[model samples]
Target: MPKPLFGMAVAFGLLLVILLTAMGSFALFDRLDPPPLDKLSDLSVEVIDRDGALLRAYTNKAGQWRLGIDLDQIDPEFIEILLTYEDKRFSSHGGIDARAILRASWQLLSNGRIISGASTISMQLARLLEPRQKRTFKAKFWQMLRALQLEARMSKREILTAYLTLAPYGGNLEGIRAASLAYFAKEPKELSLGEAALLVALPQSPEARRPDIAPRRALAARNKVLERMATAGIMPQSEVMRATSKPLAAVRHAMPQLAAHASDRLTRENPGALVLETNLDRALQEKMEAVLRDASSKLAADLSVALILADGKSGEILAEVGSPDYLSVARAGWIDMTRRQRSPGSALKPFIYGLAFEEGLIREQTRITDSPVDFGGYQPKNFDMGYQGDVTIRDALLMSLNVPAVALLDAVGPARLMERLKRANVSVTMPEGSDVGLAIGLGGLGITLRDLTQLYTGFVNGGYVKTLRDSPAEASALAQATSNMGAPILDRDAIWHITNILKDAAPPQGAAKMAIAYKTGTSYGYRDAWSVGFDGRYVIGVWVGKADNSAVPGITGRSAAAPILYDAFARSGLTLAPFAKPPLGVQEQDFADLPPTLKQFKLAGLWASPSPVPEEAPRISYPPDGARIELSRTALGRQMPLIVKLQNGRPPFRWLGNGRVFAANGRRRSISWTPDGQGQSTLTVIDAAGRADSVSVFLQMPPSAP
Candidate 1:
């Protein structure tokens, strides 16, 4: 072989050996000392509104406000300025810039001190990941190596994101998002020139130049960034001058805390979620919160207010203020009143009237006695303790006449009313060990403000109740599906009648009339004051009370809560959506023009005069003897209530189930009772005239019983 060829072969062999050794060393280093990325995932949980506006932020386990953000979420100008100020060669460098390092070294040697930083964004991110307490040569060497590894593993954008996310901005705030929100009370998506410069300058010597602590130093640092921008021609001189002229924000604004209770609940339900997106409107939530705060301040001490505003059609909760001030210890503001069940006073009257309408027992124009009357042993009086002698059903409901409502509930059956409300997905809870009675129509039962608002949505949405939801994802799913709507609370015609009557109710003083159909309710002893109203599109429910369940004397629902409801509607900045057209089979008529059966509402064996002589003996008309009846059962196999009717029964009948008295001395011929167990049972009824009837029936469980 030729001598020159041999020499070239030797050189090539040496070069290949060196390259192989370098590759082996790189692989070994990566396996032995990988980057710590677990902390990067420990970002602060954020709750945002429907349009992606921050409602609240929670610190991470480390007690740092390090919100996760991407490039798209940040302003492009801020990115350009940051890149220009931090690393001009960031885009072209592999991880470390050779030119910058050489320049920095030359400056240090020439001045005997550090002049400029040679660390790229990647190196800064490495230092953040494995933070060092002090600057040392070993730390710098490891950071440079980590930077190289990061460049090999992550894209430029990812490195930039990690760096910015972990960049400290004094105190507990770590990241541009926290700094922007804390300093400017806004997001970093659209930052001003001065704001951008301040943010860029914060990461370096963050504690020394904190804007909230040292305004003068912060201002100097921010001006330096602006000057650099001008020198680098990244920003025009005029803009740089304007930016420098702006004063630094010396005080940090509190982070957004809108919908605090709702956010808290969502975060608890969805633990480990980085971002929770709800259906709330930030502007409306802020406005309603302010209104409640202002209104609560004027009320008695320790009295708190809660409000909820939702879209009637979609059931999306736009605003939910659980309390006037979530931080007020005097008000016990941490309690979420919206979810606390309390007596709803007469706010439930419309449903009773609606049930009566549904049963063909009465119409809006039907005359009903509102004077004091006894329903069995349960008697209810009007809130004002004064009653109209005789009034139309519309007028009775408008006035919220308790006697009239209880009478209607007696005819409708308290169990049946509760059943209808349950079908509408409105939760109603009776006091422990209390039987269903007429007094429930007059605020004897308990319901939450949220459920009450949901119940009223049925009236506005043509009788169908919309299940209230706050999460945007859930709302979107609901919009695409109809299975969750469940059954209507009332027939369309009945709901229309109810809506027509309620819309005419007098508004609180200083409030506009005819804007909405509203009802006010004051629980017993003024422990709870409630006003729930609905326009064509929105439903707002307000609750005012002491968190400890103490009474506020002289505080009535119409006086306390109705005004807030009206103010909420006015400040909602929404055009009044027109009510739905009257459903089919609905008619407007005067009292004298109605049918005879529909003109007067009379309770069986109570309101109507009894016959002088018995027409026939009492006989079990339903569940005929020796018949098999299919009854509905709950998931736990408990039998649901059954309605039994008799052909003819005297007043105050006694009903027995399997020799056990279930209902004693009931006046109505039709009665509802729940069977204790599923098999053969004998139901007997004894009338006032000593006439008795008995029937044996077999109850079969429903298909869904478990």
Candidate 2:
């Protein structure tokens, strides 16, 4: 080199030494403190319906509404505006923009204050991952170093995704998805020009310019973004003007809470799941919820309702409403009534008839006596206290006569009826220290609404009951497992007989008699009223009652729950699927055309003798002599009726309450009597033979009674 060249060589050696030392220091810093990539994995758990509609979402463990996002899930126009306003040369930048940094430094020196920031999207993301409390030169330098490391380990799209996911948007909300959903009530896949502009402005000063907290600041910031887009030629001037004219959202909306109970259960079962996809139909769920709310509103106070709509063949739960109003404290709405067990009343009658048919002990046309009958000491009577002397098995089941059901249950042992239900995976809870008895056919045992609905699936699914499932993936797995290990709950012929009789059942008021087979059940004292029905493709079960197991004065399965079932089928938006055709060897016959053996359900020594025992006097079985009774009141402060029962009572009976005639002539053993007032009273019942039984009791009123 020349003299000038010697000086140039010395300067060049110093420059090269500085560059080598800087590169070595950068590498050492990167290796010692890598970008915290694992922070990106902490995202909000989401629960969605069948069509990918959000049902519910939960915040992260840190109480931040951080949701995962992807580049493709955002509108292209929003992305363009974001990149143009944040970093003009973002696509070509290598973690840090040297030209922008130089311009910022010159502007700071000239102005004596910082006017603009030179932070790229990558640097912003680095700061978000490891947030610094103070904005100093050392913090900025560290963020720049972390940005470089992030660029080396991840692609540009991945970096953008992480930025969008972790970006703050006022309050606890983070990410474009959370902000979009809260402010716009929609996804970011398709945002309006104004909406996109608002979202682009939020992350810069999330707290100060929150649309919900400070609408004017948010609007000014959004207009600034739109004006910049117009100046940069990213958006047309006309579009910018239109977007600026639009107002910002002043409040954040609540997240989707459709199928709250179902979503809550799914999240609890799968705690680690980031997203849960269920088989529920969002539209159907909304419709059913509205129906239940409307119906429950008309009911007595503190009474709630539950409904479930499922595919009978596939067992996919399309809609599940745990209560009419899940937040109502009076209704005990927090409890999931569909999973709670209660008495089924006569709802289990069809299954008992099916068991009898399967054992060749009865036929649909078989004449079964519905008259009063006493099995040892357990006497059963009809619901209305009036019974048809002799009726066909179909009539007995359709009418839900208690005596006939008990007779059939007695014919095909209650244990076997229980076993058949258990074979279909139906769980029944018998009373403590009690064996299966004839009264079980008349709501003697406890069973959940879910299990009862499952048992009814066999009638529609050709005698095979499927396991009900709400989650799509879990349903598929369970379906596969059930297919391999399941057996028919009833034979094909037996199911056909049961379905044929129930299909002719009368519909509730205002419901079109579609080709649906349904059965209604009213538990003892009306504690629980249930109606379960199945069309060609779907099975719907409705439960209406008090969650505390208190009685409703006039609630019945046919009146309270069946109307909801019929309305659900109408609003389901699904075409009524036709019932299955009769299976082979199944035929409809009249009573006289049947063989001698199948003409009637015969049980040796089971029928009561015609002669009455003079030694046994009529006795009041319930509210035993010298007892106290607690009765609930109606919503209007009217007292509910008290049911008085009698045993060993002959043909007609007379009931008197406190010397007042309650009933002049009653044929049944069970009578309903409303006391004159809540106090001590004597109830007297006289049989046809003039034999009398009396019970003295005190009626207690509820706490709120006046």
Candidate 3:
């Protein structure tokens, strides 16, 4: 080897040794760690609707309104502008910039004050990740070291993203997203040239240039960024001039408060989660919320309203408005009325009529008396205080005759209707400890708007009960909402008949009624007015009343709730679908073509033929003889009450279970019994003629398999 080459090699060895020693000596760095990249991006828990639109957002534990943001979510122009204004070579540098540092040092020394910053975007990110109040050389050195470490562990994009994620904007705002929305009332992707420049300016001196507090300063600072962009040639000088012509936001707007009740409920349901996506349609929710809010001004001061829209097919809740105003203390708008239990008046009549159709006990043309009737001292009168002596079941339902409903309920037995509702997964609170009676057919019971709307889905669907859900992707919640415990509530023919009757009922004044089938209900004493409507696609339920249950005079269901219901269907963009075509075995006929048994429904009691068929012996039909019945048993070994229904049975009858007489009533066809244990037992029923029928059965717990 040449002597000069050997000398050069020796010099390189000494420099390498000095570099190693310097690195080792600086190894004892500050204990402060970098901000967790995952945590910074996972800032707040947000409730999003079905369309992935934001409904509500909750602040982090530190009470900071830091929303998560993505690099791609921001406009490319803004990204470029941000890069040029902050660090022109951000993508190329590791963490620190040596040339920029030397330039800043000379400027500081020459000017005797800080004129320019030496920190690259990455170094600034390190300072943000572990913020410190001190402005000392040691603190800056530590931050620069952390920046190098960040460059080693993260990609260039990751480094930039961390800065974007944790960058301070103004007030409590941090990151590009928070600034964009606070100053511009839009997402970062929608920022214009001036808006982008303004956002870029705020982070440098957030409080000093905040538009809300310092508009003139904000404008001046924003123009400075525009000038920088012009200097960098990233944005044209002409565009910067035009951008300066743009106005700055004079005030900070509140974050979106849509779906307030749903967000509150869901956040509580899923605590500690960073995101709580729901199934609400953001557009529809906002539209309906506006509808209710607008209606509030026309309504009484203390009155509030709640409404919900659900998809009939999949049963997802598309929109929910819990109250007219969330902050109205007078209206008690903070209460989530959709989940509140309130009486449903005439709205339940459709189900009552459906049960009669399901049983083949009545036809549409069947004549029913709507005159004043006293059922064991309980008298049912119409809202008009007059009676239509005899009307078809079809007209009776349309006009909402209270007497006809109670009289028919007397025929069907209100208890049976309650059973059907419970079977269809509807919850009803019968005046505590009180048995369901004829009065229950006219809003004597209580049910939540959520459950009642779900129940009304029976008419929209073909008799099968499908559970309502917020988000189908949420399996655990879906499981609870849809336990599949519901059995068939009515046949397809039965549901069709009910929808057919109500679909043509008159809509509210000035509102053109579509092919939607809906029912209006007013709770007794005018405390609640409700209307639930359904096309083949959507089911909407609306309630108008005081949150305190104060009676509002003349607030009938048709007069109050029906208007909102009809207006909602007209305004909501959802396509209304036609009801299902009459299914097979559905007999649509005039009075002459109907069967003799269904031609004239006896409103008084059970059907008693003028002439008897002697050979048809009275017998038990349900829970057939010697059949094993798996009762829904509790963990403590108690069983749900099971009813034994009879066939061809006379009115005056006696029922026995386990050799103990439980029911000895006048002409009742079915009786309920609770068993002591799961084993073989005899169920016997005897008619007035002493004709007895018995069935032996074994009761066991239902299978626990999912």
Candidate 4:
């Protein structure tokens, strides 16, 4: 009854089954052997600072700097304009739009020439992922097939991100990020509407629309994109009109060059890493480098400078200006002097005095002669060549007189000083086969600014020391810092004393020294000048001089480096933090409160061997060299018996600063005198044989009225 209709139904079912089977086979083959994106995977390294600010970017193996980007990383309007201009049905189509393809085919046939591209963004991505040199029929077919495969395997957002990342915009400039940075000097996320339109239009014919070479063509292309957007109602009419009138960039900008040395070092340290993040503050780094460059003009063209700023509490290096001008051949700016070892002249005095205070060899009120003194063959003099006759230990240190500093070094012993520095994690290099000597107190040993600054950190950090680092902390860095820190260089009492003294160090004219405790040093023949200072927050070390070690006349830490240091702190905008509270037992005392031996540092018995016979060499026995004698005070607060005694030396002896003077007679070994005041005073005993001994004893007289 229905033979023809039944035959048609059976053939229809068979045809449906055949089409389904063909589709399943094609999908399976496409999944198994998809298009490869091997070429696009070779990305260049991106070096960033602590704040994720770009420092430098390198090119890929193909010598093109095509940074990867995501659709979300760009403005939504940019995506809208791109889709409306390139492919209207991009989101709905599998890969290619059939209607657009048919229209393109009709146009080509009617005009006998290629009219429009029926390629979606995914199709463009396919071509970028597996580029073909020629626009042939076979190439187009493969691109369409690859686009379909990509659409099936990846999400729309992933496909769009890849397209924005890999799209070629002309010679060695690929992707929105690269092109935006090149033309706008900014990131894709920060591009304006006009900037986005220009980028979207350029990829269609990158060479033809290159703004640097053909501004008119780029403008026309961008205007056409805006017109299309307006016609499609993608963006508001006002925005379209505004964007169309905006100008295109006529020149390309170079990429960022912040932290050049740090970035170069990071690449060398962590090769093969696609991205590196450091601990440096890019803004601070750039600012400090600018400061250094500005200061470079004042220095001789042949001289350079180096600076490092680090958080004292954490030892994180915030900024490091390796040289005044890294590219200046005349200044040898390529050398990172912060790591370069140079003499640290008077900069070492604080540590030497610190060691002396630790050993109870001297006190802040101890009276030390600044007159010229020689230790064996080594002789050190003051910077001005004029001694301050008699100066307090604090005065000696604050003034940076070389003689008194050497005297303290002689007392502590040079080897012990070096041992303390090593325990505090400072690398030291002495002359080959030479033993540690007094000259170390005057920059005798070779050391780098890094080591010197680290030592000072220990001195100022309440005896705590740690390794300074430029990049983020690593296990190795922490281990090195751990090995270097924690064991106090001196007791809190000693460290506090050193800090209190250095805090009062005078600054150069028109500089703020109270904000930081700093010291300056000039190497031999003024070859190197250094000013290292620290506040409650950061420790900054600066070195200025010729890299070749050629002496520069009149260059010194006080004049050249200190001024720069203060200026740098001012420019850094870092608030001067307060110093840590002084530890308990760090009592402030005047001269009369110091021990007898501490009153005047003795040099006679420093290296004296045990005496064979009882020789009359003049020895004071009552109040010993370091003896603390407390005299009773009467109601007046300034009355007591201060007895002075001596043993050994010729009979007749004379005591200066005492009303009674002995004549040529058998020495009255013991004598008694009334306290003149409650402060410290130097007591001198001279034997008839011309030998003498001096002791500074603190007499506990009554406190004066406030």
- Shift in Å, residue 606, candidate 1: 3.3
Better of 2 and 3 by TM-score: 2
Off by over 4 Å in 2: 1-24, 473-485, 609-706
Residue pairs that clash (backbone atoms under 3 angstroms), model 3: 651-667, 652-667
- Candidate 4 on 36-132: residue-level lDDT in tens? 8775577767887778777779888889987866576788878888988888898899886766766675566556788887888988999998889
> What ranges in model 4 sit over 4 Å off?
1-36, 70-72, 110-115, 473-485, 512-514, 585-587, 592-597, 604-706
**Candidate 4: pairs in clash:** 591-680, 592-679, 592-680, 592-698, 596-625, 597-625, 597-626, 651-667
Model 2 global lDDT (CA atoms, 0 to 1): 0.82
- Candidates 2 and 4, the one with greater lDDT: 2
Q: Tell me the tens digit of each residue's lDDT in model 1 across 269-291.
A: 89889999999999999999988
lDDT of 3 at 435: 72
**Which stretches of candidate 3 lie above 4 Å from their native place?**
1-26, 30-42, 472-486, 585-587, 605-706
Model 2 C-alpha lDDT per residue in residues 595-640, reported as the tens digit of each score: 9988877655856834544646778887788777766543222354
| Candidate 2 RMSD computed on C-alpha atoms after optimal superposition onto the true structure | 6.6
Clashes of each: 0, 0, 2, 8
**Cα distance off (Å), candidate 3, residue 40:** 2.6
Q: How high is the lDDT of residue 684 in model 3?
A: 83
Q: Which ten residues in a row have the lowest lDDT in candidate 3?
A: 632-641
